[model samples]
Target: KSPQCTPDQHLQTQSETQGLESAQVTKPVEETLSSLSALLISATANPENVLIDALDRKVAFLVNFLLMKYRMKELVRKADIWKMIIQDDEDHFHEIFLRACEHMEMIFGLDVKEVDPTRHCYGISIKLGLTYDGMMHPPEGLPKTGLLILILAEIFMNDNCVSEEEVWKVLSKTKIYSGQMHFIYGHPKELVTKYLVMEKYLEYRQVADSDPARYEFLWGPRAHAEVRKMEILEFLARVHGTEPQSYPSQYEDALRDEE
Candidate 1:
């Protein structure tokens, strides 16, 4: 027969087992803290990296703020930006603002124009003559720049005008159907027929003396002023992986228009 274990021995064994379990649990936590401390040390060693990282965050914040203003059709003020982002840091304000503006222009195809120097009021506008808005992978509150480009190109390709039906046909091919909700563009029909019309990007009007009163789309005054036929042709060429000269008639027409 085996000897019975004493109460003290049993208590001691339980204590040892508990100690071992506690150590096992604590080891990973200690290791994680050590790793984090090393990372912090490495980051602190490179001041430039820290500065760049901070600046990038500020720039991203400013871009998102400006995009929000654009979506709301509101003007941005220098004072407001300083108050919001710069806070008591006037020394870095100019650098941050310039970087943010450059990012806005390069990535969103937006121009941060100073509308009023005295009041320090700024207005955002789309870049002229460029169909691409760098919106291939847009962040929050993405604009409908790509859709606008496609519609403008379609109109240019179809002899400077296209019927509403034809416009819908082209848009449908891109999975943007009329009266349907798109993740990015909202309602395609309303966006095209109403908002774009109001913005003077496209002129939608009743076709000439049609019995059923069909509508047609034409390049609006704003579109004509902002973009050119050649630019539109080049945009199309890029999309098709071909040269603008591939379409001889359109190329000639663009040249004549340019001349």
Candidate 2:
């Protein structure tokens, strides 16, 4: 017969086996617990990121919608934007709309102005003092507002009038040639000499008694009505990273113009 085991010995052996099984079981449980903890942390951290991403998507949608309305020459109603993007988030309508407007102005050089406060209707216009022409054809053309501003600034700098040659020289530095069709602003020559003139933002006229029939640019009636000298000076100063008063002559002239 096989050797007989004592009862205590059998009990001890059984307990040891159970202990080994317990050890084996504990490790996987601990690993599972750790994984769950990591998942919880990740879930907790993701809400803010998710919110930001959602907000950005909404703002983009609103921007594209606004651009579409502007291209179609339709009035933008606040209710429509709310319906499209902020359907249930009524509290965040203003915030989202503000962000969209800021994006339009900053990126596309466009402004969303409140055309009808009672009806909450808005209209798109070119930034930097252009309140006319909401139709930026093709809806994808790059804005010419910046170029217009630069031209206006040049005119202001050159004793309130700038010659065609001088303007072309300045534009050449920006890689904009006269006759070439630019990818953004179409033909620079026609844009400057015709469209802007027709818009009443620039006055291009033949210089008096020039044998070659030269032209000069001056601030048109619309420019005078829409923008002030000080505002342009401040814009230039901001570009140069200086105060508007740094240019003493222009500053004084701007001050007088303000008065």
Candidate 3:
């Protein structure tokens, strides 16, 4: 879709920019930039026929100008869009284009989302929004099993490890264990194990080679990508009035006791 700005609006903006009456012969830089942004958004939404010449000289020049004015190189690094607009040794300009995407909140970043627990799979999500909801509930696509795994990860954030038995104990403390302990197809705890293993959201390794080997769980790639230590600490501080400073000491004690 084209830009929603009317011709009159564009003319007024152009006139303001030039301090002269708008002319039909020459388009103002502001109008060009707005049109470029609209085209980019449209291209993003329509992958099959995306405009390939988005990096043409005119668009590139405008993108570079905007980036330099905003000073947003670091956010571009986080968004990870270097390959899109990179040309020759013009790495600096590519980063600006990327940072613009992030600043607009059109392409925020990767977030891990659990899609199916019974099938044991997860999906990568693009985080997009101006406001955060605070991690009160599991993210939209996360399954119940994924939620349990995430809770276990947060609980063992300090030590970075938990035994299978300890995980069960933590799960038991939840209301699900008391009143609702079953899924339609199988048990809830088993679903948690399957989901975590399938998605690699939690690592499961045997402690020994035995008939019934004991296992330990650790945060996996998805967990590391999505959850942060500070997030867990902040959540605990808000919920339990727990001091953030106490975590390290408590974690140390737990580690020693585990040993």
Candidate 4:
């Protein structure tokens, strides 16, 4: 989830140098990407134990971005006006997402592709789960990782699996700016850093589309309410399991209640 800046007023010029856009934006993503060359050279073991330090230098830029955007936020005097413009759900989030993609392409090794908002939901849902909250339109109220952590939970809660395709499709939607060579909102380097941070919980699982009906139904503004009801009941019923046998009985009982 995106962290709220300390405040536009609190940010200082010294702090701006610490943010994400300083170097990685100017250099190649691989140049900024972590490598095991040093670790490999130092190792005596037959097989080098090279740990991939994804962010070796990523945070320097991300922090700066937050600060840059924070200062920009301060330039606007109207509090409500700022809220409408910068909230995660607003189009501004998309702008950030687009800028972020600029850095993501190089760091994460993504190829350009078209994103189907429905299919892309998996990855977007994961990131946004951490950013915007269903309960709180502005999750700035939550802990630093609160929105981020909950997003990891909500996204992986269903199945602990992420597909590269899912990630690629979503990243495809971001706009790449030529000038900064990073996200207009933040750094691309954070793609690897944030992914590394969230990876432990986001183990990918295969989502099956065995049924034609299941494939046909996904996200929609007017999704079938009855189907949604069944999904809620079924998901809840599945969670009620203590043992395999009793779960069948619980499922039946739950279905009856839903009916």
Candidate 1 wrongly placed segments (more than 4 Å): 1-140
Model 3 whole-model lDDT (C-alpha atoms): 0.40
Task: Give all candidate RMSDs, comma-separated.
Answer: 26.1, 30.5, 23.9, 22.6
| Candidate no. 2 TM-score | 0.55
Q: Is candidate 3 or candidate 4 better by lDDT?
A: 3
The lDDT of each candidate is 0.65, 0.65, 0.40, 0.29
List model 3 lDDT by residue over 1-259, tens digit each.
1112123354345434222211110122224334444554554554476555544432444344333322321222222223444544364554444444322221112233335665534343334211221222223221233233234433344245545665554444332242354321135454555555566566676654534777666766665556545544443443344565555644454445345
User: For residues 134-250, what per-residue lDDT tens digits would candidate 1 score against the true structure?
Assistant: 233323367666567667766666556666876776566455689888655667787789877877888998766677788778877778777888877775565356799977777
Best by lDDT: 2
**Candidate 4 Cα misplacement greater than 4 A, ranges:** 1-160, 176-181, 184-190, 193-259
* Separate clash counts for every candidate: 0, 0, 0, 17
lDDT of 2 at 253: 77
Q: Please report, as a residue range, the 10-residue window in candidate 2 with the lowest summed lDDT.
A: 1-10
Worst 10 residues of 4 by lDDT: 214-223
Winner of 1 and 4 under TM-score:
1
- Candidate 3 lDDT for residue 98: 45
Q: What is the lDDT of residue 98 in candidate 4?
A: 46
- For model 2, what is the C-alpha lDDT against the true structure? 0.65
